[model samples]
Target: MKKTKSYKFKEVDLVSLRELALKVKNQTGFRLRYGGLLTILRTNVEEKLVHTLVQFYDPSFRCFTFQDFQLVPTLEAYSYLLDSPIAEKTPFTGPGTSLTPLYLLERSNLKTTCQDTLEDILALLIYGLILFPNLDNFVDMNAIEIFHSKNPVPTLLADTYHAIHDRTLKGRGYIFCCVPLLYRWFISHLPSSFHDNSENWSYSQRIMALTPNEVVWLTPAAQCNGHFC
Candidate 1:
């Protein structure tokens, strides 16, 4: 029999991706598929913990959370965030760093239930990639003062995540973050798309609005924290 493609989240309902990861951790005492508790703790466990941290720091996390197969707060929210004056300045800099939503989340003390730190940083990095395509280059600019183009950043990010997944889990070359699989697992819970038209309607508009900085918006609260924890 042909085996169906599998994701980290699995096809189960009533369980968020984050909850699932935590469950895995609880059941096996670690996130890795194999033994070596310390190894799993270092990589997957740490990342999951960070996701929890960000959520705790930003109770108004709908902007980063997913909904109905799309991001929360809508693409419009992303537009508002980017169009804001702060987006133009260098992030992680004195004032500019303060402007980043990630920092805002960190300050809120929102509250999460995980034990890893590196994973949290990884999640934040991915979240940053989604929320700010030009996040890295806010200080210097050409005469045009335009942000460098990483158009279709979401697609590239997805590809990169997949590459990292294959390299780490399938190839054993390096450790990979579980967030991508975790995100995909959650996205699978959304209502399936109906129409087949590749380029038509608000759907595409909404997706284009995502940018790389907006993809994590694809993850949902249901997918992040089901009652399993």
Candidate 2:
């Protein structure tokens, strides 16, 4: 008997990203105070590394336009992983245990080719957001608190100085904290599946709706180098 060819399944998430985009778009200009929403988006001690990476891109991201960030790819990728079962648990706090989400993403690689591709997509979305402008206040500020901070212009210039060349800079403290906050925030607002059974939602729903606000804040900066400053 002839051996059978294996089949691979590929999926993408569009709805989820759109929903998330809408939320981001709705950000009232009320959050437009001094430091503003953009500041939070740019907060990072290692700004130099962040800027260098962003500058290498094709069109070169503008700090303002929402579409310039290229969110579609990430949305498509994240949707694929959203509902899969956690086959194993790896505690992430130390050298021996690989518990971070990135490490876990590696594990998914052995299980499916799509896993690696999905991870890449998610990373790209994060990259665009980080490169967006005046994100310092967006880093640690509340969706509402974004309007209360100060010095967005100076903060942006300072960050640009930091982001120009190094590849070693990681993420800001707030960036790491923000990921979970965004996750939790996503859970609170999304449908029940986002917590218990995310598989049923449309690919777009999963991708867009689950975008944590904190993730929006930290992802761009996180991608600048390798660490979450």
| TM-score for each model | 0.19, 0.19
Query: In model 1, where do residues sit more than 4 Å from their true spots?
Result: 1-147, 150-165, 168-187, 190-229
- Per residue, candidate 2 scores C-alpha lDDT tens digits across 1-229 of 2221222111122233233333343244323311122223333323322222233222233231121232211221121212112223331121121123333234434445353344332233222233222232221222112112221222223233333212113321222112211222222223444435436664333434444342243333334434331
lDDT of 1 by residue, 1-229 (tens): 2121222321111122233234333433332321222221222322332232223111233222323333332222222222212233433311223134344234333356343433333233233332222223221222012222222223223433444345333422322232333333333332344223365545423333334443343333323333211
Best model number under lDDT: 1
Per-model C-alpha lDDT, please? Answer: 0.30, 0.28
